[model samples]
Target: MSRPRRLLTLGHSYVVGTNRRLARAMAQAGAGEWEVTAAAPAAFPGDLGPITLQPEAGERVVPVSVHGAGRIHTMRYGPELRDLLRQEWDVVHCWEEPFIVSGAQVAAWTPRGAKLVFATFQNLPKRYPPPFSWMERYTMRRADGWIAFGRLVAEVLGARGIYDRRPHRVIAPGVDTTLFRPDRDAGARIRSSLGWMDDAAPVVGYLGRFVPEKGIETLMAALDGCAQPWRALFVGGGPLEAEVRAWAGRYGDRVRIVTGVAHDAVPDFVNAMDLLCAPSRTTRRWHEQLGRMLTEAMACGVPVAGSDSGEIPFVIGDAGLVIPENDVAAWTREIDALLASPQRRADLASRGRARAEAEFALDVVARQHLDFFDNLLMETR
Candidate 1:
C-alpha cells in the first residue's frame, strides 16, 4: 500500500475546540488516505476572556506558544512551529489571512516539496498599507493554492489579481450537525428559563455581534413593526450591548438579550428560536463575509431570514428568506409573513437543514477540502 499523505494545518482559531472541527473532520474523513495534524496556540485572548487550547479526541493536535497572542496581524508562532515546518509534509494549510505576519512566516518556512494553501475570509478589495501589502505579496508568491471562505471572497481576490494564475476554491465554513441539530426539548427548556413557557409567539433571533453593521437597529424596528405576535432573543455581546439591553427593556419578558453565552451552549439558544435573522448592513470597508450563524441555525432546523448584504444571500441561497439590508418595512413584512405561516417556516427549515447537510456539514466540507488538496498535489506532480 502507498504511504498516506501528511497534512499539517495551523490556525489561531483552533485554540477553541469548536473551531477545530474542520481539522478533526478532515482527519476522520481522510482516514487511511491521509494523516492530519492541527497546530494551535496554547493560550490566546478571547472576547470574553483567555481561551486555553481544548483539543478533541481522535485528532492529532499540538499546542504551540504564540507571540502577540491575540493580535492577528502581528502574531508569530514560537520556535516549535519552525521545527514542525521542517518535517516532511505533503500539504500545509494555513487558516490565516495571507496579509498577516503569521501567514508570511508559514509561507517562508513551508518545505519546498509541500503544497501550501492559505484560507481567507476577506470579501473586500483594499490597498493594504506597507508591511501588510509586502506580507501578502510574499505569501501569495509562495502559496501553491488558496481557499476563499465565500463566493464574494473569491471574486474580490480574483479581481485584485493577487491570485492570478494560481488555483483557488470557494469553500464555505462547516457546522457540526450533531451539535446543532433540532432539539425541541432543549428549545422548551430555554424558553421556560426565559419565562416564555406560555408564550406561543414565534421567537425571532439575532446571534452575532451586537454591532451597528449587524443591523441591530433594523431588526429592532422590524420587531416593532411586525404585525404578528413575536418574541425576540439577541445572543452575543459587543459595543451595542447597552443599547440592545435598553431596547429589550421596553418589551420586558417578551425580549431577552443574552451576553457571554459560550460557543458550546449556543445550540440551546439557537434551538429556542423559530427563526434567525442576520440583517447585516454593508459599509465602505466591511460587509458580512459569511454569517456562520445562518448555517448553525439551518443545521438546527430553524428557518432563517437575512439581508442581501455581501454573502448572506449567497449563504442563504433559496433555503430561506432574503430581505434588503436596510429596508425596515420589507424586513417587517417578510418576518411577519414567515411568522404567520408555519407551513412556510417548516418548508424553509427542511430546505435549510438539507442545505446544511449537503454543503456545510463538517464531513462534507472536509471531503471538499481533501479533494482540493488531492487535485493540487496531482497537478504539481
Candidate 2:
C-alpha cells in the first residue's frame, strides 16, 4: 500500500477566507491521491478566529502567525512551519508574491525530493533592495512551478529578466460560485437592512481597503459630480477610514459604510449594489492585482466599473466598464450612463456573471491547480 501524497499550503491571506475555500476545494479534488494541510495565521485579519469553513475530518489547519505585509522587514512565522519542512512531502505551496521574504523562506525549506510551487499576484514587477531582492531571486530559482493570477504578471517577470524552464500557469484565484452567486431577492433584503426601503436610486459599491492606491479619492470626486440620485456603499477598513467616513457622511442617509462583515456576508453587500467600482490607480509601489471585488460582484450579477490599472481590464474582459485610471470625469460619465440605462446594466450583469462562472469558479480553478501540481510531480518523477 502506498502512502497518500502530502500537500502543504502556507499563506497569511487565509484569514480572508478565499484561501480556505481553495484549500477545501483542493482537498476534495485530491482526496484519493493527496492529503492537504494548510498553515495560516492563528488570528485571522481583524483578529478573527479560525474560518467558518471547518476542515473535513483528518484534514488540518495548523495555526501560526504569518505577518509582514506592509513592513519593509521580512515576515515572521512560527517554528512549526520550519520544522514541518524537514519532513518528506510531495509539494510545498507558498501563496505570496516573492517580493515578500517569507515566501523565500518557505521555498528555502523545500525538501530535497519535493516540488516547490509559488503563487504570485504581483502584476507590476518591483525592484527591491539588496537582501530582499536576493531573497526574491532565491525563491524564483527554487520554484518548480509558478501560478500567476494574470498574464501581465508573467510579463512583469519576463521584463525583469527572471526566467525559468519550469511550467507556469496563468490562473485567477477562484471565487466560490455558491457563496457569491446572484440572488433576485438579496438586493431588497440588503437595501432594507440599510434602511433604503423602496428607493429605486442607483447603488454603487466599493468593497476593499480604504487605501490611496484604490483611488478612493477619485471615486469620491466622481460621485461628487453626479447630478442624478445615487447611493454609495463602502465596505472595508484601512488607514483612510476617517476620510472614507467623511465622504460617506456627505451623502447622509444614502451612503452605507459597513465594517467587519463576515466573509459570508460579502455577497449580500455586493447584491445591494447596482454597480461595483474598482477604480484602482497604479502607483510606483502597487497596482491593482486581480480586482477581486470586481469578480465577486460579477458573480453576484452586479455590473462593475474598473480603472485601467493592472489586471482590471483583463479580469473585466468586456463584461463591465473600464475607464482610464484616476480619471474622475470618465468615472462620472460611466456611472451616470450605467445608472440611467437599465438594459445596458442588465446586459453587463449577465455578461459579468457568465465570465465569473467560466473563468473564476472555485472548482474550475481548483482542478486546474490540481492538474498543474500533478504534472509537475510527474515531470520530477
Candidate 3:
C-alpha cells in the first residue's frame, strides 16, 4: 500500500486539551488512511488564566513558543513552527482566522505540494483595516480551500466573493458525547452541591460568558416575568459577573452563578439543568458564531432554548425552542411554556440528544473533516 497521507493542523486554542478533541478525533477516524499531527502554543494567556499545552491520548501534539501570545491578530509562532512547516505533508490545516498575521505566515511557509485549508468562525461582513485586510487577501490567494465553522460564516464570506472558485465546506464544531452525556446521578450531585437538594423546581441554565452581548439582561427580565417557579444557574465568568450576581440576589436561593469552571466539569453543570438558554444578542460587530453550549447541553440530554441571533436558529434546527433575541415577552412566554410541562421538556430533550449525536458528536464531525480532506486530495491528484 502507498504511504498514508500526512496531515498537520495548527491552532492556538489547542493549548486546552478539550479544544483539541477535533485533532484527536481526526486521527482516530482517519486511522490507516491518514497520519495527523497538531501544533499548538506552549503557553497562552486565557480568560481564566495562562493555559499550558495539554496533550490528549491517541494524537501527536507539538508545543511551540509564540510571541504576542494572546493577541490573535498579531501573534506569530516561533522559528520552530517555520521549521516544521518546511516538512513534507499532504495537507496543512490552519485553525486561525485568515485575516490574522499568523495565518499569512502559515500560508507563506506551507510546502508547494500540500493542500492548505484555513478554518474560520467570523460571521460578520465588516471590512478589516490595513494589515489585517492585506493578510486576508494574501492568505486567500495561496489557500487551496477553507472551512467555515457555521453557515453564517460561509454566507458572509461567500457574499464578499473571496472564495469565488475555491472549494469550501461548512462544518460545525464537535462536542465529545462521551464526556457530555446524560447522567442523572451527576445532575443530582451538582444540584445538591449547589444547595438545591429539593429538586422541586426545574433548573434553567446559561453556560457562556456573562457579557452584555450575551443578552444577560434580557434573560434576567424574562426570568423575572416567568410565572412558573424556576431556578436559574449561570455557569461562566466575564465582565458582567457583578451585574449577574446583583440580579441573582433578588431571587434569593432561586439562582446560582458559577465562575472559573474547568472544561471537563462543564458536563456536570449542564446535566444539572432541565433546560439551557442561549440568549445572544447581535451587535454591530459581533453575533453568535456557533453557540457551542447548545450542543453541549443537547449532548447532555438537556433541552435548549436559544435566541434567533446569528447561528442559534440554525444550530437549534427544530430540536429545541427559539425565541427572539431581545424580546423579553417572547422569551418569557416560551420559557414559561417549556417549564409548565415536563412532557414537552422531555420531548425536546430527546430530540436535542438525537440531533447532537447525529450532527455534533465528535466522531460524526471527525468523519466529515476526513471526507472533505479526502475529496480535496483526490481533486488535486
Candidate 4:
C-alpha cells in the first residue's frame, strides 16, 4: 500500500526551513509514514524533489511558485504554487507570512473537503498598511482554522478580535535538538572561531533584527552603563547598524558586531556567549512574540536574560532573569548581579538546558505538530 497522504506547508524562508527540520524529525520517529511537501517561494522551478537535509540549509530547499495576483503581496513565488497546493494532502498549513496566507488561499480555492490551516506568528499588532490588513483578515477568516505559535500569540489574536470564532490551536515554534543540543567538542571550536582569548572579556550576545522594535539600542546603552570588562556581540544585521556602532564607540573596545550569521551556526554563536540577552521593548509595533534566540541559547546550554515583552516572560520562565523593558538601570543591575554570581549563572544554564530539552526538543515538538495536524484533518473530515 502507498504511504498516507499528509501535509502541505506554505511559508516564507525561515518557517519553511524550520518545518523541514520537523519533517525530518517526524521521518526519524517513524511518523515518516505520511507524504509531506512544502509550498514556499523556492529559488527555482519544481519541488526541489525529495531530498534529505544537508548540514547546509540550502540543500533542503523545495521548489514552489506564486501567481502575481493576490489579496496579499507574497514574496513572489512562481505560478507553479497553485497546482502544488491542489495535490492530495491530508492537511494544508500556511506559515508566518501570508506567502500562501500560510496556505489557506491555495486550500480555499482547492476542491472541497480540504483541511486548511493558517499559522499566525504575530503576537503584536499587525503592521501592514491600512486597506491591506482588512483583506488579510478576511483571507484568514476564510481558513478552516488557525494556529498560534504560543499562548501569548493566541491571546493577542483573541483580544484583538482576529480569531473569527473558528477553531484554532497554539503550537510554538521548535528548535532542532539534535543539531543545537550541548556539544562539549563544539564549544571550544565556537569560542576559538569568535576570537575569545583566555584574557578576553565576558561576551554578551543578541540575535535578531536590529530595528527599533528589537530594543537593541537599549541593550547598547545598558552595556555601556555597566563597568565590567564586557564585549557585546551581535549575530544579526539591521537598519540601525551605524547608530549601534556609534553608541558602542563610547565604551571603547567593548563591542563587536557581525552583520549576520546563518541559522545552522546559531548554536555555535550562542555557545560563544557568557550571557544572551533580548532587550525587546513592548511598543506599538513591537513585541518579541517568541524568543527564538533565547531558546536556541538554552539548547546550547547557555543562560539567557531578557525583558518581559510579549511571550518573553513566559518564554524565560524561571530559566533566567526578567527586567522591565527600557529600564537601563534595571538592565545594569541584572547584568551586574549575574556577573557577581557564577553559581547563579550556572544554575540558570542548567535550568535553561532542561527547559530546552523538555519543552522544545525537536522530536517532541515535531510530534506535537504532526499530531495536531493529523487530528485537525481527521476532525474536519
Candidate 5:
C-alpha cells in the first residue's frame, strides 16, 4: 500500500505556467500511482510559490540552491545538489540548461543503479553557447535516461550519446487542452475586453517571454508591412520589457500589446486571435525550445504561422505554415492567404486541433510520462 517508492522530479522554473502545467498533468495522470515531488528556483515577481506541484499536497520539495546555474549562482553554483542526491531518488528529472548537469551530478551522487533523466523544455538552438557544450556530455554521462519534448532535443541528445540505444522516452510537454479547446462564443468576450475593432479586423497574437530572442522586433516590422488591415496582440513579459514597450508605443492604436497578464488568462487571449505568430530569429542567444505558445494556440483551434527554426517544424508537423525566420515577405503572403481564404485557415485549424490532441494534450502527455515511469521502474526492478 506504500506509494510506489516515491519518485522525485526536481527542476527549476516550476513556478512558470509551462512547468506547472506539465507537473499538473503528471499529477492528474499518476494520481494514486506515485507521490510526485517537484523542486523550483527562488521566488520571482508574480511567481505563485517556490514549491508548487498541483494543489499543495505538499508533496513538492524546494531544496536550497547551492552554486546553481544562471546569474544568481555566480560562484557557489552546483553546491546545493548534494542534498538532492543524498535523498537517493529513484529518478532525477531536470528541466533546462544547467539542470542536465545538475541532474547528472545528482545521479552520480546516488548509489549505483538509480535512473537519471533530464529534459530540455525550452528550445536549445535559440540560446546555444558560442561553442555548444562539450560539458553537456559530462552532465549526461552517468545518466541512464532522457526525455525530449520533440525530435529537436531528441536529435541533440542522440548525437551526444545520451538518447540512443537506451530506454528513450519521448513524453513531450503539453498544453491545457481542456482550457484551450475551441470555444464557439469566445470571440465576443475577448474582443470586447480588449476594445478590439469588431470581428472583422484580423488579429495576430503571440504569448511568450518578452525577450529579444523571441524575434518580436521582426514581428513588429512585419506587422508594419502587412497591407491588410490587421491588429497584433502580445502577451507575457520578461527581461526585455522596455524594448517591447518602446516598439508597441510606435504603433499606438494599431498594435494592442498587453504585457504581463496572469498565466491562466493566456487561453482567453489565445482564443481571441485569428492566428498565432511566432517570428523567432535564429540568434546566438535563442532558436526556441518547443514554442509552447504554438501548441497552446492550436489547442484553442486557432491557426498558427511560425518560423522553421528549432522544434517548431517538429512540433507543428503539417499543422501550420512554417516560414524562414526573418522573411517578412513570407509572413505577408501567409497572412494574406489565411485572411483572404477562410477555408485554408479552417483546414489548418482542424489539423492543428487534431495534432494538439494527438501529441500535446495534457492527458496524452501525462499518460506517456506514467507509462515511461512504469517501464523504467520495471527495468530497474
Candidate 6:
C-alpha cells in the first residue's frame, strides 16, 4: 500500500469553531490517503480558549503564537516551524495572505518539492513597501498555488500584479451545515427564553464586529426610518460598541444588542431572525472579505441582505437581496420589502440554504481542497 501524503496547514483562524469544522471535515475526506496537521496560535484575535484539536478528528494541532498583538505582527515560530518544515510533506498550506511576512517565512522554511499553497481574503488594492513587499515578492515567486476566498480578492491580487505569476483560484472557506442548520423548535425556545415571544415583529439580525468598516452606522440610520413592529438584533463587540449601544438604546425594545456570544451559540441567534443584514462598506484599509456571517445565516435558513461592497453581492448571488453600500434608503427599502412579503422572504431563505449547501458546506469545500491538492500531486508525479 502507498503511504499517505502528509499535509501541514499554518493558520491562526483555525482556533475558531468554523475553521475547526473545516479541519475535521478535511480529515474525514482524507480517508487515510492524507494526514493533516494544523498549526495554530494559542489564541486568535477573539478566541476564548486554547488551540486544541478534538481527539477523534484524526488531525493534529500544533500550538504557535505571534508576537505583539497590539502592533508589529510577526510569527514567533522561532525554530519550531522551521524544524517541522524539514520533514517530507506533500503540501504546506498557509491561510494568511501572501503579503504577510509570517507566511512568507513559512515558505522560506519549506523544503523543495513540497507544494506551498497560500490562501488570502485581501480585497484592498494596496501595495506594501520594503521588507514586506520583498516578502510578498518572494511568495509570488515561490508559492505553488494560491486560493483566494473571493473573486474580488483575486482581482485585487491581479491589480497588484500577482496573478498569472502563480496558479490561483477562488475557493471560499466552508461552513458546518449540521451546526448552522435551521431548527424552529430551538429558535422558538431561544426567543422565548430571551423575552422575544411576545414580540411578533420581524427581526433583522446582524452578527459581526461593531466597527466603522462594518457599516453599522448606515444600518442604524436605515433602522431609524423603518416603521414600527420591526426589531433589530446586533450581536458582536468591537471599537464601535459604545455608539451601537447608544443607538440601540434610542430605539428601546425595537433594537436589542448582545455582545460576546460564544461561536457555538451563533446558530440559535441566527435561527431566531427573519432576516440577517451584513451592511459592510469598504474603506481604504478594509473591505468585506467574504462576509462569512451572511453564509452562516443562509445556512440556518435565514434570508440575508447585504451591501454591494467587496464580495457581499458575489457571496449573496441571488440568494438574498443586495443593496448598494451606505445607501440607507436602499437598505430601508429592501428591509421593508422583505418584512412585508413573507413569500419572498421564504423564497430567499430556501435559495440561500441551497447555495450554502452547494458551495459553503464543509464536505463540499473539503473535497474542493482535496481535488486541488490531488491535482498538484499528480502534476508533480
lDDT of 6 at 373: 83
Clash pairs (backbone) in predicted model 4: 48-63, 65-78, 66-77, 66-78, 94-102, 94-103, 95-102, 98-101
Which tens-of-lDDT digit does each residue in 1-381 have in candidate 3?
999899999988898888889999999998998899999999999877788887766679998888997678899988989999999999999999889989999999998899999999989987999889999998999998999899998998888767756789999999999999999899999999999975579999999998998998899999999999999999998999998999999999899999988889999999999999999999998999989999999999999999999999999998999998999999999999999999999999999999999999999999998888889999966
Q: Tens-digit lDDT track for model 5 on 1-381?
A: 665645666655664545666666676678887666666544432332344323344346565453434342222325555565567566666664533444445545655556666665543533234223544555556556667777776666555444465566766678788888887567557777777656667788878877767777777777767777777788877777687778778877656767657667778888888889887777765567788889988898999988988877878889998988888777777787777777988999999999999989988987887677677878856
Give the least accurate 10-residue stretch of model 4, judged by summed lDDT: 44-53
Ranking by lDDT: 1, 3, 2, 6, 4, 5
Alpha carbon lDDT of each predicted model = 0.93, 0.83, 0.92, 0.70, 0.69, 0.82
lDDT for position 76 in model 1: 94
With a 3 Å backbone cut-off (N, CA, C), the pairs that clash in candidate 6 are none
Could you tell which candidate, 3 or 5, scores higher by lDDT?
A: 3
Task: Write down the RMSD of all candidates, one decimal each.
Answer: 1.0, 2.7, 0.9, 4.5, 4.0, 2.1
Q: For candidate 1, lDDT tens digit of each residue in 158-273? A: 98666966899999999999999999889899999888973579999999998999999999999999889999999998999999999888998889988889899999999999
Question: Cα miss at 178, model 4 (Å)?
Answer: 1.9
lDDT of 4 by residue, 67-88 (tens): 4423335434445766676667
lDDT of candidate 6 over 16-96, digit per residue (tens): 545766667777898789888887666544444444433334458776666543332454455667787888889998887
Q: Estimate each model's TM-score.
A: 0.98, 0.91, 0.98, 0.85, 0.82, 0.94
Please estimate how well model 1 matches the true structure, expressed as its whole-model Cα lDDT: 0.93
* Candidate 5 Cα lDDT to native: 0.69
TM-score of 1: 0.98
Alpha carbon lDDT of residue 113, candidate 2?
87
Which has the higher TM-score value, candidate number 1 or candidate number 5?
Answer: 1
Runs off by more than 4 Å, candidate 3? none
